[model samples]
Target: MTGSGTPPTTIPGSDARSNGLPEAAPNPGQRVLVAGGGGYIGCILTRCLLDRGYRVRVLDRLYWGEEVLGHVIDEIELVQADVRDFPGSALEDVDAVINLSGLSNDPTAEYSPEANWQMNAVATENMADACVARGIDRFVFASSCSLYDGLPAGMHDEPPQSSRAAPTPPPSTTASSTCSRWRAIPSARCRCATAPCTAGRRACATTSW
Candidate 1:
């Protein structure tokens, strides 16, 4: 069982030939670019990725303080940039992209709906497009459980209907959009996994072409 306490379950549709997420271990030294690496989830993921022997680069606007990433500062490269304006040059040579950029939590989204849509929705699609354009095959989108809101306790295990996509809440339009983009990519392999939610835990879906 993972730290989440739920016995681990294989996320539907995961394929090792695609994004490499399901691989027992990713090859050492493969470079992965993490957008929004300054945030809480990103900070934790960055360290873990490093420990697994992958090279990491972070692109963030630093909406939060940088102190969380300080411990790994020298080990990884940091690019101060927003997901909306991320440069293609940065994607050069990157083997994969992990997108964590977005308006986190309901309060922040409520405070600025337009900004939330732009950052969470618009920018997420942009990242997928950019990755495709640059020939980056792997993408992992860190999405929130806000999508699962109102789901009945037992219904959480229910499969998506017809659409073949995960059921998401209205608040997570961004995640839905990102999943749409992955679906549009015919060569991409996609998987939706429900991670155990802790006090502030986040979950992600992985895709690859």
Candidate 2:
């Protein structure tokens, strides 16, 4: 085992007495933090994650509802907190973050687009940044299709030549531009899934979840 020649061999599944391949240990919580866990979707998500053996934490303003989470209060970590003031320390060991706190496409954005932008767009962008900075790469954003203002002008049934509007792959960068670049955190594994409609989750729960 000379340094210049080859490193010492490591036995599979052995301790220091032989070679230091570690013994199997239970998963390290595989922690997940749901940003709005008191809401309808958040509560259900927490339970679903918990049932799958992932450790879960709930950080919510709880302005809408908390009763949905009452039964599982004992099994989870609850923080009545806002995304703007998310405590960075708690995220240190977390594996993923699913942010659901935002003003849904409600009429209130008209009163103050500034506030809405701050919470919905800016805060979410910053949340991604924070997660990357802290090595939590997996981030799932609860955004809406409302942002997709433009679509392919031609229906799928129509031939390409019949299309009135030109389509050129839409710049080949929508997802990366909006989300994937932030997943570069080397230590943190990442995924950004736009949660489907509320019904999607419910349906998943019925069959696969």
Candidate 3:
């Protein structure tokens, strides 16, 4: 308390600063977290980020061949941790996050539905919450399109994108579609690169979700 009766505060660096919450902005160049940086597309993204001079930190279980990023190992920081158990410290001082971890697709998913849900669905939701708590900026996500399953026999194939050439949903039955059809492959892994919550950090996503 102040001598007169008011609470007292001081500067941070120069002998006295208020709690020091905003003394200066953080330097953003240090590092970025690529959650699934070892996956197919993630490998490319990791290289691109490294080429630009940002410190790259890759968090992956190496579910696939680790060689995917062999060419650039020296230039990146690798973390072998599953997103489901992602350490809170992993989000610290991170400029961005590109989430590419998840159960891949149908065949693999059927192998173990419980595992898929635990690794893909649950982990993603938690990661979103963690990022919010951290102050990290930006996320690029890649999600599977399986969630859009239509009623049994109630839905038809989506129309092509090239034919429409406009912002309109294709008619219920367009013979051919400009848009490419998505297929579920055997691999079952989380591909949610960037989720909606990341957008608050001006995140960029590559997934369909």
Q: lDDT for each of the candidates? A: 0.66, 0.60, 0.54
**TM-score for all models, in order of appearance:** 0.71, 0.62, 0.56
lDDT of 3 at 101: 74
- Candidate 3 lDDT over 68-105, as tens digits, reads 87988888888888877888878767766666676655
Off by over 4 Å in 3: 1-30, 145-209
lDDT of 1 by residue, 1-209 (tens): 35676777776435444333544454679998888888878898789789878899999998776787898999998998877787777787898887777777767776987777777777877777777776676776655444544454443332322232433333345565666557676876442222323111223222311
Model 2, position 190: C-alpha lDDT score: 56
Question: Best to worst by TM-score, what's the order?
Answer: 1, 2, 3
What TM-score, to 2 decimals, does candidate 3 have?
0.56
> After superposing candidate 1, which stretches have Cα over 4 Å from the reference?
1-24, 152-155, 158-171, 187-209
Model 1 clash pairs are 147-169
Clashes of 3: 30
Worst 10 residues of 3 by lDDT: 174-183
